[model samples]
Target: MGKITGFMEYERLEEGYRPVEERVKHYKEFVVGLTDEQAKIQGARCMDCGTPFCNNGCPINNIIPDFNDLVYRQDWESAIAVLHSTNNFPEFTGRICPAPCEAACTLNVNDDPVGIKSIEHAIIDKAWAEGWVRPQPARIKTGKRVAIVGSGPAGLAAAQQLARAGHDVTVFEKNNRIGGLLRYGIPDFKMEKWLIDRRVEQMQAEGVTFRTGVMVGALPSEGPAAKVTNDAKETVSPEQLLAEFDAVLLAGGAEQSRDLPVPGRELDGIHFAMEFLPQQNKVNAGDKIKKQIRADGKHVIVIGGGDTGSDCVGTSNRHGAASVTQFEVMPMPPAQENKALTWPYWPIKLRTSSSHEEGCQREFAISTKAFIGHKGKVTGLKTVQVEFKDGKLVEIPGTEKEWKADLVLLAMGFTNPVPTVLEAFGVEKDARGNAKATTDFIGGYATNVPKVFAAGDMRRGQSLVVWAIREGRQAARAVDEFLMGFSDLPR
Candidate 1:
C-alpha cells in the first residue's frame, strides 16, 4: 500500500463534474479528472490490509494496491504497468465502471475506501499524455489467423491480446465503424467516441486488422434491430469464417432489448431504448438520420429504472422534453445501506445517476399495464402499483392510474445475444440463450463448435464493460492454449 497511516490522515476525494447547466447544452463527457496532486493523495489513502480484496472484487482482478502504492510514490510509469498487467482498458473502466473495487476495499469496512477508479483514470490519462501508450506488436509471427466477430470491448480485448501473442487477428464489425455498443448504444455525454477511436488506432498499430461493415452470420430479426446500425457492405457466412481463420471468437454484445408486451405495444410512439438512444448517437457522429426519434416538447415516459432508463431521462432532457418520468417495477430501495452488513459486497441502496439529477420524475414499484394511444401513436400510459407478496408480485387494488405520455421508451434490459448468430454457428446455447461456454480454469471460453470460441456478453449475457474485458482477455488465453497446446499470455 501507500503510507501506513494515510487512511487515517487523508479523506476520500471523488472526481469533480462540470455544472449541469453547461454540460446539458451539448453531448460531451462532463466528469472532470483529478489533478496529479489530488490523485497522489487519494492513492496514499490505500491501507496496508493483510488481504487486498479489491483485486478479487474487480472483474479483471487489477492489482489495485500496488498501483495505488506506485502512484503514491510518484512512479507513474510503474503504476500504469501494474494497472495494464491485469486490465486491458483502464480508461473505459475508469470512466464508466461502478467500481466494486472501492466497495471491497478493506478500509471501507469502517471508513471511506481508496479512490481506485479516480487513480486509474489519472494514471491512464497521464500515460497517454506522456506518450506512454504505444503499440506492442509481436516480434515473431505465429502464422495463425484468428477472426473475432464484434468490435466491442470484449472483441477488441481478445483481438489485441491474440495479436500481441503473435497471431494474425482480424476484427469483424457489422456497423460502419467499430466499437459496437461503445460506438452506438452509449451516449456521447457519458463517454466521448474519441476514446474508442484512439484505441482502435492503437490496435491497428499493434497488427490488429479491423473489417467494418462486414456482418457475421444472419440477423435474428429486423424488428429487434431495426433502429440499430448495421451498415454491412457484405455478409460473411459461418462456414466462410471457419474455413478462413484458425480460430473464431464471438464477442458481439447482447443486442436484443427487452420489451414490454402490453396493450398498444405496436403504437407508433413506443420504442425500445436502443431505438431512441442510438439515433442520437448517430446524429452526434454527424450521420444524417431521417425521421429520427425525438423527445422534444413531448411528455416522455420511460419504463425501467436501471442505467438505460436513466440514460433515456438525460437524453430526453437534452432534447427539451416537456416532461420526463421514469418507472421502475421494483420497490424503491433505501437511500443508504447498512455498512456493517454489506461492507464487502454490492449493497442494495438508492443509486440516483447524474442523468436523474438533470431533471426527471422517477416512480418505483409501478408496473405498466398498457399504452394508451390515439391514431396508432402512444399518447399516455396505464400503470398500477405493485408489491411483492410471498415472493410474487401482486398488484395493489385501486392503484391503477393513467398519465400523459407522448413518447414511451422501454429500458428494462437485455435477455440474451441474437439467436440467429448462434444458430448459424451451431454453437451450444445456455438456458438463457447465450453462447454456452465454461469459464473453468483449464477449459474456459470453449463453445461446442470446434475451432470456435465465445466470450463477453455473447457468452455471459449483458454485463459491465470491465467484465467483458476480463472474459475477452481470458478467452484469448484459452484460444492460444488450444492452438499452441500452451499459452504465455496472462490469465
Candidate 2:
C-alpha cells in the first residue's frame, strides 16, 4: 500500500459546503470537493487493514482500499479505473449514498472514518476533467434484443451492462426524460442534472437506445393523476412492448407512495411527497409549471422523518416558507451509536442531513391523528405524542395538539411498486408485492414469467441508488447468460 504510515500522520479531511445563506437561495450542488493534494492526504488516511470491511459495507462492493491506495500513490488513472470497474456512477453515489462503507471503516470505531466518499467524488470528477472517462462500445454485436422498462439507476445499469455484452438494449421510460427518479424525483441541489445527461450520452454512445415518454402498460389518454411532466402525452401498452422485444425487464421503481389514511387526508393542501418533489425538479429543468407547489409564506408541515421529508424541508426553505416542521413517528435515535455493539453493520443513529442543518423543527415520537382543515383545504394538523409499550405504539393521554399548517407533505416512504405494470407482465410478486425474482446463479433474475427479469426497487422494494445499480448489473449478467447460453460479463 502507498504511504504505509500515512494514517498515523494524517487526519481525515471532510468536504465543505456552501454558506447556508448563499446556498438556500438556489438549488444547485453546494458540496465543495477536495483539492488534489487534500484528496491524496485523505486517501492516505486509509489504513492498510488486511480485511477491508468497507468493501462489504458498500452496496456495489467498490474496491475502496485499492482506490485509496491508488490515490495515495498519485495514480489517478488507475484509481478511476478501479472505481468504474465496480460502480457505474460514482458521482451519484458519492453525492447521495449514505456511505455505509464509512460506517464499517475500522477507524470509525473510534476516530473519524476515512473520507472514502469524498475521495471517490474527487477521483471521478478528475477523471472526467482529464478526458479519462469515455464510452466503451462493445467490440461485437450479439444481435439479441432486450427491452428494459424504467430508466432509473437499475434500468440504466442493466442496459449498460447488456449493451457492453453486445446485446441490443432499449430502455423505455414513462417520463419525457431518460433518468427515472434521478431526473425528476431528486433535487438538483443534491446532484446536478447535467451529470445524468452526461451519463446518458455515454450510454447512447455505447449503443443503448433510450425511449422516453413511452409507458409500457396500457396507454393513458390524459396521463395519470401524477403526471411527471406538464407536457401531457399518451402512454404505450404492455402488449406492444412484449411483441416488439425478445426479452423484457421490469425495472420500474416503487412509485406507489405510502399514504397516511388518517382523517382529512382528502384535504386540498395535503399532497404526497412525489406530487410536490417532481414539480420542483421540473421547474429546475426550466419548465413552466402551471401551479407549482410553493411553500412560500406558508407554515409547511412535512410528515415522516426520512430522506424524502428532509428533501421537502430543504425545498420548502428554498421556497421561502414561513416555517418548516418535520414529524417522526418513532422516537429520536441516539446522536451516536454504540459502535462496540453494531460494528461492521449499519447502526441506528440520528442523521442530520444538509437540509436539517439549513433549518427545520424536528419532532420525534409524534404521530399525526388527523388533518385539521376547512373548506376542503388543510389549515392545521392534529397530532399526539406516542410511546412504544409492549411492542405496540400507544398514544399518550392529554398529549393531543394542533399546529397551524398551510401545506402538508406526506413524505412517508413507498409501500410497493405499482402492481398494474407487474400484472401486465404476469410476473409473480413476493409477500411485500415486489417482483418475485431470485438472484441465485441458477436462474438469476428470472421471475415466474419466462423471458422476463426484474431488479432494483421493482424486485427488492425501496432501497438506495447504489443497491439498485448492483442489482441492475447482476440482472444484466443473468439476462446475458440466459440469452447467449453463456455470458462473459462480470457478475
Candidate 3:
C-alpha cells in the first residue's frame, strides 16, 4: 500500500457525468474521468489485506491491489502493465462493468470502497496519452490458423491472445463493424465508438485480421430481415469458413431477443429492444438509417427492468419522448442490503441507472397482459399487478389497468443464441440452446465437434462483457494447449 492511513484521510471520489440537459442533445460519452492526482488519492484507499477478495470478485481476476498501489505511487506504466496482464480491454469494463470488485472491498464493510473502476479508467487513459499503449506482435510465427466468429469482447480477447501466441488469427463479424454488442447494443452516450476503433487498430497491428460484414453462417430466407451494411453485398456460409480455417471458435453473442407473446403482439409500433437500440448506434456512427424507430412525441412503454430496458428509457428520453414508463415483473429490491450478512458477495439491492435518473416512471411486480392497438399500431398496454405466493406469481383481482403507449419496446433479455449457426456447424448444444462445453482442466471450451470451440454468451448464455472476456482468454489457452500439446498462456 502506498499510504497506510490514506483511506482515513481522503474521501472517495467518483467519475461525474455531463449535465442531463446538455448531454441529452447528442449521443456522446459524458463521463468526466478523474484527474491524475484524484486517481492517486482514490488508489491510495486500497488496504493491504492479506486476502484480496476483490481479485476473486472481478471476472477477469484483475490484480486490483497491485494496480491500485502502482497508481497511488504515480507509476502509470506499471499500472497499465498490471491491468493489461489480466484484462484485454479495461476501457470497456471501466465504463460498463458493474464493479463487483468494489462490493468485495474490505473498506466497503462500512465506508465507501476504493474507487477502483475510476482509477482503472484513469490509468488506461493516461497510458494512452503518454503513448505507452502499443502493439505487441509475436516474436515468432507458429503457423497455426484460427477462425473466430463474432468480434465482441470474447472474440476480440481470444483473437488477441491467440495472435500473441503466434497463431494466424482472423475474426469474422456479421455486422459491418467489429464490436458486436459494444458497438451496437450499447448506446454511444455510454461509450464512444472510437474507443473500439483504436483497439481494433492495435489488434490489427499485432497481426489479427478483422473481416467485418462477413456472416459465417447460412443467411435466413425468411423472418425478420437483417439490416445490411454498406460495406458488403453478400454473406458467407458455414461450410466456406470450416474449409478455410484449421480451428473455429464460435463467440457469436446471444442475439435472439426474448419476445412478449400477447394479444396485439404483431402491432406496428411494438419492437424488440435489439431492434430499437442498434439503429441509434448506427446513426451515431454516421450511418443513415432510412426507417429509424423514433420515440419522439410518443408515450413509450419499455417492458423489462434490466440494463437493456434502461437503455430503451434513455434512448427514448434522448429522442424527446412525450413520456416513458418501465415495468418489472419482480418486486423492487431493498434500498440497502445487509452488508454484515452478504459481505464479499453480490447483494440484491435496488439499482437505478443513469437512464432512470434522466426521467421515467418505474413499476415493479407488474406484468403486461396484452397490447391494446388499433389499425395494426400499438395504442396502449394492459397490465396487471401481481404478488408472489408459494413460488408462483398470482395476479391481483382488481389491479388490471390499461395505459397509453404509442410505442412498446420488449427488453426482457435474450433467451439463447441463434440456433441456426450452431446447428449448421454440427455443434452439440445444452438444453438452453447454448453450445455444450465444459470449462475443465483438460479440453476446455472444446465442443462435441473436433477442432471446434465455443465461448462467451453463445456457450454460457447471455452474460456480462467482463465474463465474456474471461471466457475468451481461457478458451484461447485451451485452444493453444490443444494445438501444441502445451501452452504458456495463463489459465
Candidate number of the best lDDT: 1
State the lDDT of candidate 3 residue by residue for 1-491, as single tens digits. Answer: 65798888989998998888998888888899999999999988898877888999999999999999999999999999999999999999999898999999988899988999999899888989999999999999998899999899999999999999999999998788889987888998888889999999999999999998777775445333242222444577767777887789999888777878888898899988888998999988788988899999999999999999999999999999999999999999999999999989988899998899899999999999999988889999999999999999999999999999999998999877777779888999999889999999799899998899999998999899999999999999999998888999887
Off by over 4 Å in 1: 222-227
lDDT of 2 by residue, 155-227 (tens): 9999999999999999988777778877777888998899999999999999999987676764323322243
TM-score, one value per model: 0.98, 0.97, 0.97
Query: What does candidate 1's lDDT look like per residue over 100-181, in tens digits?
Result: 9988999888888899999999999999999988999999999999999999999999999999999999999998888998
List all candidate RMSDs to the true structure.
1.0, 1.8, 1.6
Q: Tell me the lDDT of model 1 at 417.
A: 82
* Per-candidate local distance difference test: 0.91, 0.89, 0.90
In model 1, the Cα lDDT at residue 348 comes to 84
Give residue 97's error in model 1 in angstroms: 0.5
Q: What overall lDDT, based on C-alpha atoms, would model 1 receive against the true structure?
A: 0.91
Error of 2 at 27 (Å): 0.8
What TM-score does candidate 3 get on C-alpha atoms? 0.97
